[model samples]
Target: MKKTPLFAALLGLFGSVVVPIYAQTVSLQPLWESDTTLRTPESVLYYPAQKALYVACINGRPTAENKGSFIAKVGLDGKVIKLRFTENLNSTKGMGILGDKLYVTEMAQVAEISLSTGKVVNRYSIPEAKFLNDIAIDTRKNIIYVTDMGSNRVWSLTNGKAELVVEGAPLQNPNGLLFDNNQVLIGNGDGSLLAVDPATKNVKTLGKVTGGIDGITALGRQAYMVSEWGGKVWHVRADGTTELKLDTTAEKINSADIDYNSDAKVLYVPTFNHNTVKALSLK
Candidate 1:
């Protein structure tokens, strides 16, 4: 593959590291925001089964409600409703829903909440993990993969028991993850995309990004990555070349995830700093 000029610019931008490039699109806007006092919204997920979107937020300081950090549900039409908080869930980050259960990871624990009631159903304490940043689930194996940002490791969990899958490796600041086919795709905050082997548990650098990436979501043959500090979103092809997909220079976009409603061909994205969701109609 030919080296992209953007690749060289990214390395220079971050001083020997890949820097995430922010998405630039004039049409991006706010879809929803919390009515609560929370300021820093971190991660978001869509629960197709429940027809709701789950948003996790942190106050950034030790507060009562945040000490028990919370997740809220917003309707597809932008109505926000506060949900129940899971006990001991501080600094809650990325969220994912598999089957009928909603899963969220905090500092070192992965908690499963009921889909119907929005109540905490179970909590799995990962002793070896220090900062569980994000999670990806393998429905076929009934296992959840988690990123330990503090320890620089990725772990796999089955039936609430955690096991080391990759330990003390070079996946520095690994944050966002997705499972594609049999491969695990991880987005490192330092601006690199990684493809990991589930069987051998090996990882390879797929490509480099220019800004600090915070979230990622795969859509068909493409992937959308969010630049937390760079204030953008990018469309990455399977071949590793990337382009600007969305930009929030006007809105200050942060973390993001994309879900394509196939029938409608509309892409839904939940953004962090701006505290809203957006949809791009691909007609």
Candidate 2:
């Protein structure tokens, strides 16, 4: 890996230390910013299957009864392939894919869209949900774990039935979720990165950040990148240490839900209020 002078010293210590030392002093260089067409883009998903990116656009308010939301397909190099790959959505936020289905959060429900056709094929509603935000999928059993930030809860959907995973204090405003290494990684409203064991439901704090978490994705087994809704992106390590990688709060640009193209080494960020997705390359 190429490293700057600062990172070279950091990685040098990794050879002697027993604990893994990842690239903590990671730098972000602006690569490209999409045109102001993605209104209130909430989440960005890098779909390796199609070699494209899927962006969930919350065109209007993030509330029910607003079915004007849609999904946009973007090229890997930051070009608009098809603006409206899927439409007629309701306050779309987070998205995850299972096989040929693209499951997206629609406030109080989850809409399943066909990846090939870009047509919504199934709608799973959670009547008891308040604000269903981000989603993560456990591919082993095909379970969909979604977070309800408004109600401070997490739910798992399988075989067309929804079941509560965890709720309340430990999950303060659970927002972003990721399924990695047999664990459901949650980005909490209270700025905590937690890992939950599905069988035991044991919650363990892996790290903590400054503000509420909105996006959680693993860079690798030992490192992750999490973003705050208020425009701060953090690089969190397995040892529970965090470092600020980006902040646009002063500019009032929000990083809602982020996706990283590992092959390109670029982080795709959805600036909610700014109406653009900025790709920042990891250098």
lDDT of each: 0.67, 0.91
TM-score of each: 0.78, 0.92
Off by over 4 Å in 2: 1-19
lDDT of 2 by residue, 1-283 (tens): 5668767777697743334556346789999999888889999999988899899999989988898999999988778999999998999999999999999999899999999999999999875899999999998899999999999889999977999988887989899999988999999988999999988999999999998899998888657899999999999987788999999999999998998888889999999999999999986
Cα lDDT for residue 119, candidate 1: 78
Model 1's lDDT to the true fold?
0.67
Candidate 2: which pairs clash? none
Model 1 Cα RMSD, Å? 9.3
Candidate 1 residue lDDT tens string, 59-177 = 46423245757777766665676554433467778777777788888776888988777777888888766678888888888889888877877788888778877765567778777
Cα shift from native, residue 18, model 2 (Å): 10
Model 1 vs. true fold: TM: 0.78
